[model samples]
Target: MDVLEAIVLVNDMVVDSSSRRNDAWPELDDLSAISSSFYRDTDIAEGYGDSALEMELYRLSIEKTRNLVSSGDLQRQLGFLPSMREIEVLPVIYRDRADFVEKILDSIRSSPKNAGISTELHRQLNGFTQSLNVLPDALQNFALFAFRGFYYQELAHLTSASYMPHSWRSGIIRSQLNRSVSRFADVAIGAGEKVRSKLQAAINDEFGAQVISANFPLIASFVIGQASRRSDLLRTAVEIRDSAKATAFRAWVYEMERRIRNEQDLDKVKQAQDELTTLVRELEVDLGLQRKPTQEMTLTLALPLPLTPSIERTLHVSSPAWVRRVLRRRTHLVFLRELAQESISLPPFVRSYQMLKL
Candidate 1:
């Protein structure tokens, strides 16, 4: 089979991306599959005869082709997002005009010019490098932006406490966008439709890159492989898990257990019960409950916060430093996430929240 055939089937397991079709990249289902008399036999031979890099491309090609077999309507639905995230971090956008042209050609051939993004295709793609400006911000949310919007946020968090230019994002953005773009291309082509030119350019810039395709899965696997390393990343995951409120919950549980263990004096029993009641009241205070009783009406005061950390909650944390960091950033990401959910969709991970608009 052509190169696309090899990898398309690999995703029969990874149900995240094209999870719509068992995680395979739809590009594989297109003309490149072995079913196509054109490149099928030659591709398998090239597997042996080609350079190791070419062979890998041949292999990825199989995934690309296999992916094409799924329903083509994906593009019409997800036309706005770009295919790659690196396109954003790139100091210079564009310089990859031919690739975008290839994308629009594929899109138009598959679907109507009016159905997807519906703007004039020719007007959007008029600039090559100039089009690169579209890589940053909310615009990056589209399939054209690929996963750049998400990855951009992640790397910004990873690179520095504050977002800044860095070399590392190249690797991060590459992997994310590859998955995003391939999926977008799959559905886009399947639907036989066209979106805006900026989006099409993004698809090409991301998919066209040779460097990104090579490092993505390897790095992603490595990053994902070490449970410990990931545990250390962003320094906020653990903190979020063991948030102060969560710690309080555990403390309350321990006090509850301690009371259960001791069944002696009725006064002691009553005190324990009162303490537990006070703790719950304190929680309401910490959460900023606003229904203030102006008068001393039975004193429904909030309980005080515990001075000591919750031992059980602390133990659950794999890494406290990362957890703490995440906790620090969480408020910001939460607001951003709210905006994303309300205004736009935020990607699945904290990494997707790295860069911010306001």
Candidate 2:
């Protein structure tokens, strides 16, 4: 398909999946309602356990995919129209790795001394994220399931990491690393646990059923229940990893929290932070993982649109290919591309000088 057609199809699929009522309650209990392909692929109808089990697994996969694509509640805010608002929502785009570091420093500088500045900063960040909530359903889903939970999750983590005192840098990095490990473990151990929980909640919400419905159809439910049992095995593995992490976190936090609570001397606090850092690195090795976080800094944009109810979008573009979506103004895109080409052709120092001028 052409690019536009492909894009349209994707958006249609997302909208349909998201808008469908009672989709969470698929009529899968009746085998006759399902397509022949399901039976053809499965051996369950043939009286073999293998095909039925495969069908159940496939259903779980399809269900999980639907949930992830429809999961985000990210919506755009009203009152963003440039004509109505005095100040237009300027782009707060992070372009490179350096930009991420700069944001970290900016967040550190904005940290409150007496809770006042911190409170204001928190409010502003909240407003910013609220504006982002109104992004397209598909975009929001991609951001959450594909991106770092729609940027807010990463933003919150970054804010916390930077808000600490400079002496606590090591401790902050360690905590960040721990979170990364937890995320990796979450995916590795329980592939769709998070999305599944969201889907299950949606199902329960629709049916007004308890968190789990005990009244599943006998044979069909048993087949589906087997998938849950398999997921339980993975959950057990995740729990083991989480347990080890919690033990290490507890040990480190004991001394760290004690120092903070007692208002201990800077040197002592630094010592505790150092110990935490070392412990985190050792734990990473023990867990057969990287000492440093593997996440890359993303290129993000906050662009405003002039509509009756103005909206702000959070765009996460990994490369120039995705930049087209962010550049609503074709003129801006043309200017940017020209500038990029020129910069690439220039020497490093000349390019830097031109960038500073821009």
Candidate 3:
């Protein structure tokens, strides 16, 4: 058969198999079966394809399987967060720049982090990154500065006694961070140059000179205030004043906050946060940071952070509390395994987190 016919046959096999199985997770069984054939066919198509039709059939079959799972089966499996499932399914429905943004935010929200200063910083970073493009010129420069401030602040904590002991694992994380920083340094610097150009342009506009001078202190104050919210970071900034790095760190913070007041379009703010979080964890080889208790830190005292205004409104209007409760009860590990089975590459930190428990 042709590619389309082969895809149809594979889908029918999976769907019919699901109907026949009399188990709690017949769908998973169907998935397992289809996944096997998809892989087998994919190998043949890629490696031994004597004709274009054979290659096309194998590729289409694989594509069809992913589409089916992402839209239908993955929902039932990864129901821990409806938004996450929606994120995975969204590509099938909408394929545009705006939707790309939605997809990213959804991915960021789905990323898990421990409750503490780290998590809060992660959220803020995400918000900043996602909103970067839409922000006013002054704000965009501020965001980059603020981002560097937070990055260093968090990096300091990870290097602290409270986060991880000085061991081989810690060394690995440091090495990874070093590499990541090295690789991204040029990119970050290039972006910074652009921001500086924009800042200069804004300054040359009207009364911009006085405004620029005034902006540094305002941003510095905000960065300091944010640092104060996390005892470890605040302690690092204040107590470690002698270090030149600390001085430069705070300078970057002030420089960034000099112009921006607040974030715009909170919903789009996931990229900065997600990227930082992902990179930070990538520093870890395997559970590189030793876990510490933050029970005394009053995590509950922190203000509630709704996903986005629109999501918040929709949740209030439609989704019932019981449904949320049920979603929380879903087996996270099972869903994670299913995602892997479907040939989805789970993020390293996520895989590490789950594996450490086992």
Candidate 4:
């Protein structure tokens, strides 16, 4: 078959496998009940055990291939539109690999006791184990694409609400962006730890203490490096998302300024002013300029009594702390007001340059 035909065949296989897996769940549940019963026969128990193992291997295959098919990067590479269920499943898949490998190994080790299980089934299980033995290499390839997929997913989520007011959308997207970065870092580090622990354990089992001692540090350093690479990818993703947000905000600010300059309606001008005020407050917060509590100030005024010879009186006045905050905000309000009233005209180039500086 040609490449296109092969792609179609693989897609068909994935769909069929996924459907079969879904259909098998109820039967698996029934098997679980049967295996747990007091009257269960030996043959039935053995059959149930083998079925569960086969199901697990089958499920993993389906999930891995489905993840590959659903990957955003793969879709982009192949110039295909993403499916409705296009979601990043690699983190989950990778996270479960350690336990899955352990289970497979345990079954292999105990195979001699299960004399009733067919030779064909044993061969299939061994084949599955051999396939999984190459997982460290597979993970390296899959992880790069998976990280990109996650970044694109988050970027799309953050920028999707174009209908919302720019000020509100900006604040929400920034908050979400921060949270997403934190969450992605945690997941990447956690997955790395799991894989590292599993691989280290497998090496220890195979080679014993002397070999492990010699190679332990090297293995640890490699895992840590992988985790750090994931963090770096996350950083790049954040920068791209942040730059996109800044560009959108600049466009919005320009539009609002244009409206303020040319719109005849007082209400529209006022609306623009209000939106700009919100945007300015958000910017101040983002820039670390609006966090401290306001401070009160005391002023002394000296007055001379009208008829007395050089008689002087002093009056002390104090302003409320909140007044300072209002004054600070008033600076932006005045600029917005000037824009609304057409008292100041900013050239487009200068306006864009100022925004870029922001």
Q: How many residue pairs clash in each candidate at the backbone level?
A: 53, 7, 6, 0
TM-score against native, each model: 0.19, 0.18, 0.14, 0.20
Candidate 2 residue-wise lDDT at 276: 33
Best by TM-score: 4
Give per-residue CA lDDT, model 1, range 225-294, as digits (tens).
2224433322222232234433343344334444544644557546544433333333233334322213
Candidate 1 residue-wise lDDT at 261: 48
**Candidate 2: worst-modelled 10 consecutive residues by lDDT:** 7-16
- How far in Å is the alpha carbon of 29 misplaced in model 2? 27
Candidate 1 residue 183 Cα shift, in angstroms, is 26
> What is the C-alpha lDDT profile of model 4 across 186-243, one tens digit per residue?
2222322332344445567778663332112211222222233432322222232234
RMSD of 1: 22.7
Residue pairs clashing in model 2 are 43-51, 74-133, 75-133, 75-134, 76-133, 76-134, 81-310
Q: CA shift at 171, candidate 3, in angstroms?
A: 29
Model 4: runs farther than 4 Å from truth? Answer: 1-58, 69-107, 113-358
lDDT of 3 at 37: 34
What lDDT does candidate 3 reach at residue 224? 37
- Give the per-residue lDDT digits (tens) of candidate 3, residues 126-160: 44345445534333332232222222224334333
Q: lDDT by residue for model 2 over 262-297, one digit each (tens)?
A: 677758667544433433333333334433333345
